[model samples]
Target: MNDIAKHPLAMDGKDPSNLRGDPIDPERYYSRSFMEKEWQQLWTRIWHIAGREQQLAEPGDFIVHDFMKESVIVVKQTDGSLKGFYNVCIHRSQRLVWQDNSQKSFACPYHGWVWGLDGVLEDCPDRGDFPQGDPVGKLKLSKVRVQTWGGMVWYTMDDEGPDLLTYLAPTAELYKNHQFERTVRVNWLRVALNTNWKFWSDNFNESYHTRTVHPQVPPIIDQDHFTSRYEMFPMGHNRIIQMGRPSLRDRLPDGVPHPFDDALRAWDIDPDSYPDFETKAMQGWLDLKAAKKKLWKEKGFLHYEHLDDEELTESPFQVLFPNVAIAPGADSFLVWRWEPHPTDPEKCYFDQWTMAYPIEGQAEFVNRTAVNPLRLVEAELDFREYDNGAGVQEYSDQVVFQDWQLTAGQTAGWRSRGYRDPYFAAQETRVRRFHEVLNDYIAGNPPGR
Candidate 1:
């Protein structure tokens, strides 16, 4: 057989590929030190998306997120600015906020010490009788670094990590002309799973698993035209290659509204309401053209092209390494950030947020326009469960539940004596590139460039 048939993703001078080989070493994964390093060195330093600006809409609104073992409280100040802090009370390390919502201020159930929305100490139980003479003035809730990007809240434990924009890099530009600041509906979580954080990310970085793991995703995306590319950024950050489906230029369903073309007519879309509709719609048109070219190259038929280019590019999926994955569709975008749990080897939190463009001008239509990418469309076949030689977990629920069992199963197998390192194929470049960065970080390579 030819080399292409024999070795998919073959590279020169590297060790033999690890395609369909032994599993990765479980010991490296289960090592206490590895987990601890992740907590101290990685988790604390990395910028992780916690929630969106809409979640902290009101001045006193706050959202409490449990990151690893760290409790993060994202609160909107009276000035309409947002701040993030460790949810622990400055006094006795007690949790300051139990739930997420608008409150005048955060009060510690432990000692009744309260902090303002800005995370400043604002009240104490009794100041006159204290032996330390009012420790309140000296103590304020410890603040964590926070920044908002693409209308989402992101934080880091280290005050010295890269700036939020710098950290997100080229990925941040993905939604540049889409008016993302106005689209802020999302659901996020910081799951605690025993498996390595990389496991979930690796699974997301490659589309090869889609056909088997996410049966529906494959039909939505053109797999035969698939190609995976990688770009390394400074500070050990990376972006992976995920192109639009070849069928994107295909004709839309008959009689559907041509939002892009309609805007150019005498009935112009209101700029105030549409914001960046022109740019976004133009992008959709261009994407549709790219999609049509892709389909014609691989498939011998002409697909519908009524939609704009922006619609074309916005519907595909891509991954931004270390944490975020973007799965965009016609109706909405699914954004996920994976966080390592504080104290569990068997657990990590997966925070997923969904963003949809609000149908402009019509207030009532806004709510109706909000879309969720993961919501199961009733018409499709849902083989929601997978058997990995273990008892099943749930029935036709969602692809996520399906992956939960497999990821957890892989975590369990990591400890097996027969387990060995995986040999990756060239087609699995994204996975291998991810591991390269992961190993480099673990090995204490000098950062920058």
Candidate 2:
């Protein structure tokens, strides 16, 4: 039995009739004019993730999120609330802060103008020289709307747009079982990719490409489309939940060691207890869930207490509107965000944050997407330019690294003169639905108005 919710506000994501039959124009991927449309029509209207709630534990802690050409600072207020401000100083538009740090007040380096944690201008260097009547308490930074959910800090430029939870819809409600607040991010990485930002939006909308692009995943995540569940929310977000078992059609060779066995072993289930491979793949999955339910608390996985049977062993990937995709698995969570470049439409930045729950006495975890063992602690950000695969050499074994290798070729493919509208598979219905929603936003008729 699957745990896919038929939300009242969501459409049948597997049905192509739900889409507008919109042609995904190639220009939308790499044209400057199209990029300008996204900036004016979509970017300003959507809620953006600045950072995490854990980063703002103190009253004055702040995260400076620099997106394309715009900069924003989400600060923790003295009253224990969160507020966001455009990072530009009210005077001369100088940048207020360039990094994430804790401070009682922000002093602009341009003219030593001091701004309080609440965004009020506390002091100006030249008190008497201002022609606009000293401009201290009366002047303040421009405010942006800020909210938090799922341990993530969110902000929006459109002051009147829907709240974060409303924008997230059933997607937010579906993931209530996860204690993301207690999870520690082990890998904070950003890579400058050569492909457009929409690449990730499309790439994550379907499991069709996973068998080809990420071969190793089929054995662990059950990449068969028929076995997966797809959902499309009215707010432009999408979700796909695949069972935590090996795909029968994509089985390994006889001598090859299976990843599913390792997963079963981790939960105290004997892999060799099954008589056959098919029984091990099907019956073993149910047994694995039962084993986890029986051993979670004593095994130090307190977060599993509230999780349902499906939540304890399923792989649910959520695509949040236009740019963010997240996998809130039982043991690990991954947030994948991609944004356009400052000036070039052919390039984008990809952020990968790997978070794992803290199990008592467990210092390390098996990060399926990473090469190294992930420790249960927060990690500092590591930024790199792809440089045609020369950079991030240490992440060669990571699944995302394999995806990164396709950017150079995919960029060239998009600009091909022979390019035409894509003919998608049934499993890829959400890909077309994604572009249809983009059409809605660009047409000023976004869903969930």
| Highest lDDT model number | 2
What TM-score, to 2 decimals, does candidate 1 have? 0.70
Per-residue lDDT over 223-275 for candidate 1, one digit per residue giving the tens place of the 0 to 100 score = 43233343344333443433333223333454544433432221332323433
Per-model C-alpha lDDT, please? 0.56, 0.89
In terms of lDDT, the poorest run of 10 residues in model 1 is 1-10
Pairs of residues at least 3 apart in sequence or in different chains that clash in candidate 2: none
Could you give candidate 2's per-residue lDDT for residues 1-449 as a string of tens digits? Answer: 36565668767778888887889878788999889989988999999999999999999999999888999999999999999999999889899888999999999999899999999999987799877698889898999999998899999999878989888887777888889888999999999988899988988898887777889898888887777888888888898889999998887998799999998998888999999888999999999899999999889889998899889998989899899999999988889999999999999999999989998898887797764797778898899999988989988877898889888777788889898889988778899988988988888888777
lDDT of 2 at 148: 91
Judged by whole-model lDDT over C-alpha atoms, candidate 2 comes out at 0.89
- The reply for model 1, stretches above 4 Å from the true place, is 1-24, 130-133, 136-138, 184-195, 225-232, 235-311, 314-316, 328-330, 360-398, 443-449
